[model samples]
Target: MKSKIGIIIGREFNERVRKKSFIITTLLTPLLMLGLLVAPMLLSTYSGDEQKKIAVVDDSNIIGAHLQSTDEINFIETELPIEIARKEHLEEFAILHIGKDIMSNPSDIRLYTNSTASITMEMNIATQVKMVIENIKLQQQDIENLPAIIASIQTEVNMQSFANDTSEDSGDKANSSIVATVIAYLLSFILYMFILLYGSMVMQSVIEEKNSRVLEVMVSSVRPMEMMMGKILGVASVALLQIAIWLVIILGAGYFIIPELIPDEVAMAVAMLQQGASPETLNTDTDMSLLQAIATLTDVGYLAKIVVSLVVFMTGGFLLYAALFAAVGSAVDTPQDAQQLQTPITIPIILSLFVMLSVINDPGSDLAFWFSMIPLTSPIVMMARIPYDIPTWEILVSLGILVATFIATAWAAGKIYRTGILMHGSKPSFKELWKWLRFK
Candidate 1:
């Protein structure tokens, strides 16, 4: 029986992995995800690269001298009438209008744009005007140390957090907690995407086999349970293989590819992040410690715990859902039928995803505790909590429950698959399914 299942597994794995669609999708998915992560940074960096000209209608000219040009926005003094400046051929994004009585009432100053400008554009204008106004007000008040006082206004705070779990582990808790939280959310999200994707793959594979009229011949050679498990294991293996490839590529890019593309300072920061350097260690005077905070997140024990838990949950959830989806595919003749039956099977996962998202905010909450214990939701909810201070006993209990649940679920699904895989003339009603489960 083991040999038969292994042969079936090998056959299924090879058949699917060799397909052009599978190969292309497997290789390209990581690049697409990398693009998603990198595209935003690139856009923000070059978003305002094309400098926008601002028409300065400074009648009083008190603020015109202080106005300056930045890489994002450039101010140009315009003697043209307000109406004429509005139609300036220089492609100005906005006009900074200063009334003749601007100093007594700064409210008379206004910024006009062709259309409603972005909040970012408005804020840039406000910042420049505020600086000029401050200097003017300071000059009128005869303040000598204005520059010194203004520099000290936005004081930097070097805040550090410590974990209260154990006194012996008392260093800065800032690094571990933050890094763990990020890993927990990201891993759980990845699990969710994989389960949804490959779970449906298992179901579709079964349906395609049945629809082609080869399910009967296949059944004659292998037991329905063996066939079902083999299919699940094949798809599961494929999913894991793709994930491993993506992880390697992404990690390699972060370490090697990205550094070469970015500036020296950014490359240095990325290197620091990879090496686990804390921000406080880099510069005492500067509060830029976010990269160094990631250093403590590389705790060997913490990473091992997450990896072990991730593998278990990913396996448990896939096995549990794969069986259910196989049954769904067997009961229906078409993709439409399979999707109709999928609503019940998908509800728990959907509900868990939404609830777990909220649980991520407060992993120690009562809702999170109970949800993490429920086998259906545990893979997602428990993962969200793994980054926080979860007890070992709780994780053990959850795994035990999930294992038991998957066994029961697979057995029930096997019964359904055994009957539905061969029954195909018409759609089976809910009553017929109940009888199939009771068949001896």
Candidate 2:
């Protein structure tokens, strides 16, 4: 039986790889997805390079000097009228007016623009204004070492964790949480997509075979159980191969392209080792400690455990759904008939995705825990929660139940497959399917 399953898996893997659609989609899909992810950053970079011209009417010289030197800002030191500033091409000038009311209150700096200013421009103005106020305050108080005093003020609070016998740094804990959440989301989405894509493929294959009367000849030679197992194994092998190839490509690209493409600050953070800098001196702001950041990415053992659990759940989930799809195909004579039966399978997937999305923000919540424990939803929900630090016992229990559910579902689906594949013309109702399950 194992050998037969192996043969079926091997054949399915080979056939899928040879298909033009699979080959094209496997390569292009990742690239398209990567483009979407990076598009905003690319646009931001392009916009950052463009010069922003601002006309300043400085009645009081307090803010003009401080705001003049910001990057990509061409400060035009002009006393131009507001009308002239507005009439000038919008790309060429924005006006900043300092009112006479600033002698008593230095905070009265007004900006006039035709439309709402960009976030970058607003931030730059706010920062400059803040520095001016701080300097004025220092002068008023007659404090000479204000710069040193300000530098010594600690803006970031140091955090330490004491849980689960793990000595992870605060950064490591955060990274672990992030990586776990990302991995969970990725696994859930992948399972959802693969189940829909390949499960449909299985159904289509069954319908084609039945329509052409090929299933009649094929079933005479092999038991329905063997054939169903073979088909499932074959399709699953193809999915695994495609996934493996995509992983290799994505990893390779991330390794090589990321270093060259990412901002220097982020690159530096990713490259730094945790031990290289003292925990006190480490900058929490930049990606200067990427090596440390990645090192701190959850416990390696925990990550491995979650990954393995995801594979088990995803495989079992796919098999369970694909078996139902196969049975649906067997019962139907055409693709149109299969569509009506697909709602039962598709609804669960849609619900799982919806529930997983909601639970991700609050993985430890009661709703998340209960949904993840239920067999029909567990495969996706449990994966979504794994990144938030799930217990080993919960994983084990989920797997135990998932495996049992798969066995029961496969047995039930095989009975339906065996009975319906041979019968034609009259479509089976829910009652008919229950009767078919009792067939000897």
Candidate 3:
């Protein structure tokens, strides 16, 4: 049985991975992942490089004095009429027309452009007009303290976790929470994608074999259990290979690309860490600098733990879900038939992603506790809480349940796969599947 399974695994792994699509996907997936996230950030940052010149035809005369230029836009007050400004071609992007009594009707302010006005263009003009009007209203009401009141409002509150363990520094706790939340989010997302992608692949692999009646010939030589296990294991290897490459890319980007791209943000985060330094070590404020704080946050130890946890959950989740997907493929004659069976399998995966925000905010909550431990959701949910310091017992319990679930599901799926892989005609309903499972 072992030898047969090994041969099947090798053949399946070799045959599928050598395909043109598989090779191209493996090579391009890292590039695609980086592009999806980093492209928008980079593009948006440089989007406002060129300053747009907007001519202001302020009939009210009040707005022209207060309308100041910004990095992305330059405002110049003009005495020329609106009709003449349209034809003058002053190299301006747009013309803002402020009405004489805009104090009465704010909507009278209009932006006219040679081309259609963009959202940014409209917003810039509107903001200038609104700010002038607001300042006038505040003066009229004699509310000179408005600026001071606004400045005094605290927008961000520092959250400190008060667990039994207070030996950890507040700065360390804050940094860890940030790191844990980020790791949890990435892990949950990766697990969701890995499980769905590989699980569907397993189903499609089974469907292809069944549809061609190739399983009929294969069954005579290899036991159904061996064939099923071989297919799952073979596909698992493919998944691991893809993920290993992705992990290297992710770690590389974290170490190299991130700092070069967003230096200011990196500097600010490091500054924050320095500000929140440990209370006991308050004597050496001059010595602790931004570089040291940045180094602390990017600790090599924490990153390794996150990477290992991610690899484990991603593989385990794929294996657990792939069994059901394989069973669906064996029972169904067509991809459409498999869709009905996929809903039940996919719900828990989706639920895990949806509820992860709550878990990240409060990993010790009861809701997070049960969801992370339950076998169906554990594959994604447990990893989400692991970085936030999940209990040792809970991790053990979740792993035990997940492993057991995979074994039982695989055994059950094998029974259905053996009976249905060659039996194709009418679609199998839920009742028919129940009968197949009971077969000796």
lDDT of each: 0.79, 0.74, 0.79
lDDT of 3: 0.79
For all predicted structures, in order, the TM-scores are 0.85, 0.78, 0.80
RMSD vs true structure, all candidates? 3.8, 5.0, 4.8
Better model by lDDT, 1 or 2?
A: 1
Candidate number achieving the greatest TM-score relative to the actual structure? 1
222-297: candidate 3 lDDT, tens digit per residue: 9988988899989998888877877787778777965775467455555454465443443333323333434444
Clashing pairs in 3: none
Model 1 poorest ten-residue lDDT run = 283-292
**Model 2 lDDT tens row, 51-119:** 777777776766666665555677776666556755663665467777566646766777777566788
Candidate 1 at residue 47, lDDT? 82
Candidate 1 C-alpha error for residue 176, in Å: 5.6
TM-score of candidate 3 on Cα atoms, chains taken together? 0.80
Worst 10 residues of 2 by lDDT: 156-165
